[model samples]
Target: MINRYGPYKRYKQVFGVTSHSNPDKEHTVVITDKGEWQCSCPAWIFHTPRKPCKHIQEAMKDQVVQAFTPKPITPKVEKVLNRFAAIEV
Candidate 1:
């Protein structure tokens, strides 16, 4: 039986998510600096925003792969502030 979420133990084995049956394999689920997301799942193929789909969910559960949450932009904001510098009257 396909568990509602699939086998967590097996899902963690997933290296990443990708189209189950694509020829060129151009479409893929990339686990990168960004996060765990898939652009090519039935749920995402049409309606969903940029969020993950069942396939991604399965992959994550099975693979034990945790998504990296990027730290808030405070540092980037600081850098931008430094770059602009305050204008003197």
Candidate 2:
């Protein structure tokens, strides 16, 4: 995720969606590194308050697999783990 720009990052998954009206057409839906949702569609351009386009919506729902979140270990648990690590098995 890091680049010469320093801490540069972007979503690894980019969705290419076929147009509902025109099957020949397609759009790109992605979440920017800044955590902004965007779509490469006309509606994605003209909206005053940006809203999720149909393609973006579909892409979101399709994202069944998500990034993992690690649970924080309590201090008491950490202490027990440290003790176990010091023991010679």
Give the number of the best model, judged by TM-score.
2
Q: In order, what lDDT does every prediction score?
A: 0.36, 0.52
lDDT (Cα, tens digit) per residue for candidate 1, span 1-89: 01122112212221323344753332322243334443334455565345676665665574453444322333433332233222111
For each candidate in turn, the TM-score is: 0.35, 0.58
Best by lDDT: 2
In model 2, the clashing pairs are none
Indicate the TM-score of model 2. 0.58
Tens-place lDDT digits, model 2, residues 1-89: 10011111343445556778877665655555666666667786567677898887887776664553323443433343334223212
Among residues 3 or more apart in sequence or in different chains, the pairs in candidate 1 whose N, CA or C atoms overlap within 3 Å are 10-62, 11-62, 11-63, 12-62, 12-63, 12-64, 13-62, 13-63
RMSD of each: 14.9, 19.4
lDDT of 1 at 74: 37
Residue 10 in candidate 1, Cα distance off native in Å: 25
